[model samples]
Target: MNTFKYRQKYKSNYFEGWYIRLIGKKNIAVIFGITTNKDNPHAFIQYTDSRISKYYSFSLNEVETTNNSVEIGENKLTKNILILNVLDIKLNIKFLNVKALKKNFINNSIMSFLYYLPLECYQEVIYLDGEYTHESDKGRIYIEKTYGKKFPKEWIWIQSNSLPLTLASAKMPLLFNKFGFYCLFEYEKKQYIFASYKLGKIKIMRSGNTVNINIKQGRYRLELHLKLNNTVRLLGPTNNGLMTITVNESLDSNLSVKFTKKNKLIHQSTHKDIGAEVEMKNHS
Candidate 1:
């Protein structure tokens, strides 16, 4: 199922969230989501402008979604349209030239492994790239959905349509003192995955506001250099509810990437104004 339809499933410690990002000309951006955590489920909309940043939250009961559409209070999100009406902010946008990532063996294998884990979190990319129009201006947009019992203790997520890449690497809790380190990279239209089920290696280092990642799987290797700035706090999900954890995200960031096959450089590029999240600190 490419779309999320989990309203029927009921659990004490379950959580689900969808992340949507819209970029307009001159890098004007909006990021928002609807989250359902057992503790304090809610829907939120957030945006930052040159003068100030604003966030709005709504009760969980006001949120509803199907395979193709999402309604959060007065906000509506679908494959081709997004309408937001919160406080003094109002937005009506349309998406064009939509391109979605297709399911592949890599993603399927990762899902299979997560399904068997005790602390499971499933992730899927609903849309890879699309043209978003706000009034007379247009920019790019990317969307993703995630669900799980709880988030990993530590993880890093970075995505950029300008770079046309997505990377998620995490360390998840498991049974028998076994921990899972999973990394999935979508670059140059190819999926390079590293998980517990594969013979691969991943190294991550964080220095200040920058993160460097190196991943090797068979003959393929990828190096990602990410820098974060203008970060803001975003509500995150937990077993108890939305207040159990804090997520720090930045829409103004930079990403430099390199890919190699058999020791030969395949592609290299750098992109700016990326969407990134780093949740490594623990909060009780």
Candidate 2:
């Protein structure tokens, strides 16, 4: 028997429970495998506004585990992948050998995947890199939904057909947020989708001089090649899915971004139609 406990919080929804983790250390199976629609021993969830907890929910990939204590091939087994049936949906997952448990369940119990969570399945994730030095400046970014304790780093981004801007530590001047404000630049009416992290990977498809952002979710991985191809499509786990985009760009390289999940076809960079001035103004 194992135990797992944790708390989950959302702006609109509420969830925090001591779930059960089941591992079959009692069995003598050589290799335990599984399939699932959620992550191993855990599930990813999102919340919606103006709704109850059940109404605003979604899930992503899942994991399963076994208790053979040996390295086995990733395949299905003749056992029930899930030990607990508390979550709304049921998915398949496998295990190797039962280890520790979590949430009143097994801790770090290895499992296999039968399916993945019902993500929007964007087929794309773009990674952005930068630092956030100011409070007000950071608040201006609509990413507060994903914000955490720190200054809020590790950006996930998306963009339009226009040119994309890359911000380096050297390119973006250190900013102050409390009292002062500053102007971001736009070199040629381009757009910028970005996030930041200590390190991660990026995959993209480039056509001619311009580059297409297929996935932009985390830092760069030096050991692995970051490119989108038929053989290697899934870019792996990101910090989160929230992404940002700068609708306006020019040579000055200042960042004016509106956090839209989808890229809008028309950009209002003009004084009237574009509302460049009003766009810059963010009120509490």
Candidate 3:
């Protein structure tokens, strides 16, 4: 598949980016984004680790896309390998036991029917669970991509490779007000899902730096509670420009998740380190 299809079409208010997370000795995240806002269309990269974070900008022409790879300047990303050279940091990482989403009606894309329709923002999962190695430091990794005009005003994103779970809820444009969705596997050796179109109900609550989410669909229920820790601000694309710190990602956060079926516990996990980005309607 052409993961970089949006990059070729130079349209106004268009943006595409790949989110790459490398969990090794230190949790690290890299964002490669290209925006075509007419006035200021450029390609940029953002980096964040436990200690420091930085951003780099280049002309749009610096971005190169292929069948399965996207390269910007000296950095390159593919399904199997990732090469990076920014500032003093360097890595030549290789993904192992990579698991891509199945190619089917619902599994092929997370958006389901909404994927065919044009929306402000569309997200795709490239890799569900994978392992990475960079010399002596080795850990888990997750890969995904987003292409559209701009991000949602409010959203919550959380993922854990150890649990092989990913959940997201965003304020989508159009008839839908706010949508909550999740995809998970390897839970008691079974696959369970909760999505907007699946006739699921979700409730979100926020108090200070802690947030809790509950989703119920038929006989399945998933709950996620998190407390922010070691967070760093990251810029996101907007109609005005790519200057808004729309995302504050927590590198190492406390997360506890529960999955149940038929009013019985199926699986549960607690992790001290996880990847998350959350924005609530009312935060006190």
lDDT of 3 by residue, 1-284 (tens): 44434443336767888898877788899987888777777888889995677888888788888778878899988878889888787889999997666665544676677776767777777777799999998988888888777788788888777777777888776746665565555564444557787788888888877888888899988888888787788888777345455578887888898888898998788976688888656542
Choose the strongest candidate by lDDT. 3
- TM-score, predicted candidate 1 vs. hidden true structure: 0.84
Instruction: Mark the regions of model 3 whose C-alpha exceeds 4 Å error after superposition.
Output: 1-10, 240-243
* Candidate 3 clash pair list: none
The Cα local distance difference test for each model comes to 0.68, 0.20, 0.77
- Cα distance off (Å), candidate 1, residue 11: 3.7
- For model 1, the stretches where C-alpha displacement exceeds 4 angstroms are 4-9, 26-41, 48-53, 105-116, 175-196, 281-284
Q: Which ten residues in a row have the lowest lDDT in candidate 3?
A: 1-10
Sort all candidates by TM-score, best to worst. Answer: 3, 1, 2
TM-scores for all candidates: the values are: 0.84, 0.19, 0.92
Q: Where is model 2 more than 4 Å wrong at Cα?
A: 1-6, 11-80, 83-91, 97-222, 230-284
Tens digits of per-residue lDDT, candidate 1, 99-163, equal 66655654433354455454556666667677888888888887777776666667788888875
> Over the stretch 188-282, how does candidate 2's per-residue lDDT look in tens digits?
44322222221212333334222222223333111111111111011112223222212121111112333223443223231101101111222
**Comparison by lDDT, 1 against 2, better one:** 1
